[model samples]
Target: MTEKPVLDSRAKVIIAACEMIGENPASTLSVRTVAARAGVSMGSLRHHFPTQRALRDAVLRTIYDVATSDDEVIYDRSVAPRERLVHCLRQILAPQVGDEARRAWTTVFDAFIATEPTDETRAAYLTMAAEGTRRMEHWLTVLDEEGALVPGDVRQHANFLNAVVNGVSIERALPTETSVLERETATLYQAVDAVLRAVDQ
Candidate 1:
């Protein structure tokens, strides 16, 4: 029989925070909530994470790791660069579609927009946004190394792509007379083509 894996206090705390964030990205990860969730004492949680920011950052790092754990396609040179890049961008937008997207936006509005946000709330939201921009930059850098991207600042390109994706994601959550998938695809390719060099180039 296989032995059960062991998790220390720190790991358990992080896991608990990640689960809370997964359930509601905008939810406040208070020490009390996480400690109860992790089945650890408040002292044990504080011993590992000290401050709310520390806990929040640790949880986000774990999430980033999990999200990129299967990102082999980011470096796969076999696929055409434009196609590969578009596919990667689509993954960012995929989660922001349909009723789920509407719910997500509603949560964000309720948490951060509808009222004044606390320092912790503001910091958490900004950190999440910064993490997203970094991921886009990582993808663009790979294409740049392959000589498949236009000559430009990687950050600028990443920001532009991120902005386009954000706009499309917001649109996806709104009511529309027709399905926007095709339009979204066209818009993504247009953004990709602007940054990526032609295949023959």
Candidate 2:
């Protein structure tokens, strides 16, 4: 019979931090809170993760790993490159729609915007934003390799796409009389086509 692997103190701390992030993406992860949640002493938690930034990075990395492990659509070549890229980018904005988006924005306001910003809070927000940009860059890199994208800076293109998605997401959270999804699709297509080669477009 196969034996289950035992989790060490460090693993436990990471698991606890991941759970906290999963519960509230915008919540500040204080060392004291994560230590208590992990059932470890502050000394132990700090031993594994020297700083709050360290802990935050580990948790974010873990979340990214789990989230992207099964992302096969990015590699599926049967779909046309433009359509595939659009589909991949749409996944980023898929969750930010309607009432759920409103609640998420409310959480963001309470956690990062409304409150007096601390260094820790500012670092956390920046880390999350960087991760979002990194994900976009990865998608763009894949499309570029497929010879679908026009010659340009991959990072710049990713940042532009990220900004566009963020703007559309925030708009979706607000009161809108028009068809938000339709507009969102049109916006995504425009953003994708802007970076694609004429043949690919």
Candidate 3:
């Protein structure tokens, strides 16, 4: 039988590079920088990613994985769809009484917007966004089948709600008063709740 290759090493490099990029995307990222953080040599980094563009793209993909993941949550099917939807939106926002989490999210997201990469990178970003939206849509569909949303275009609404949640994080990055944060948070939750109710009704 063929031997299993060392998969974990390359993954470690990507994960570390991703965290670094998450910390700061607008700053110039060098292979040496990522390698040093990953505890791998520049040659090792180059071995996985031949070009800076490729490495950056990989980092983008990894960034998506690091953020907005369902992996950390324990999904309980016993929960109602409406409840599940609310929980998911809350997780996506990941807001605290203070805005530290939202600020961190803004840093990574701004970097994603600034990073110049290949067509594949752009496509990958779009694809990941679509996938998250689709997950919401899937949840909506289930609710509908179970006779739970008002029902029109579930996917469109899901995307809209996801955009709303994303915008809330981006907006929180701005220097704003606590009142503003409160207004934005309420708006986000209301928008999500509205879609859920509309689709189910």
Off by over 4 Å in 2: 1-8, 66-70
In order, what lDDT does every prediction score? 0.85, 0.83, 0.65
Instruction: Compose the digit string of candidate 1's lDDT tens values, residues 29-114.
Output: 99999999999999999898888888887788778767655568878778788888888887777655688888878888888899
TM-score of 1: 0.87
Task: Provide the global lDDT of candidate 1 against the true structure.
Answer: 0.85
Q: Estimate the overall C-alpha local distance difference test score of candidate 3.
A: 0.65
Instruction: Residues 97-161, candidate 3: write the lDDT tens digits.
Output: 34575656655565566566556556545555665675667666766676566567888788788
Model 2 pairs in collision: none
lDDT of 2 by residue, 1-201 (tens): 999999899999999999988778886788999999999999999999998888888888777656655457778888777887787777776655688888877888888889898887889999888887788788788888998888999999998888898888788889997777788889999988898897866
| Superposed Cα deviation of residue 93, candidate 2 (Å) | 2.2
Candidates' TM-scores? 0.87, 0.85, 0.58
Count of clashes, each model: 0, 0, 8
Model 1 RMSD vs true structure: 2.2
Question: Which of the two candidates, 1 or 3, achieves a greater lDDT against the reference?
Answer: 1
**TM-score for model 3?**
0.58
Ranking of all predicted structures according to TM-score, beginning with the best and ending with the worst: 1, 2, 3
Residue 60 lDDT (model 3): 62
Q: Name the runs in model 3 displaced over 4 angstroms.
A: 1-7, 25-78, 95-128, 131-147, 179-185, 197-201
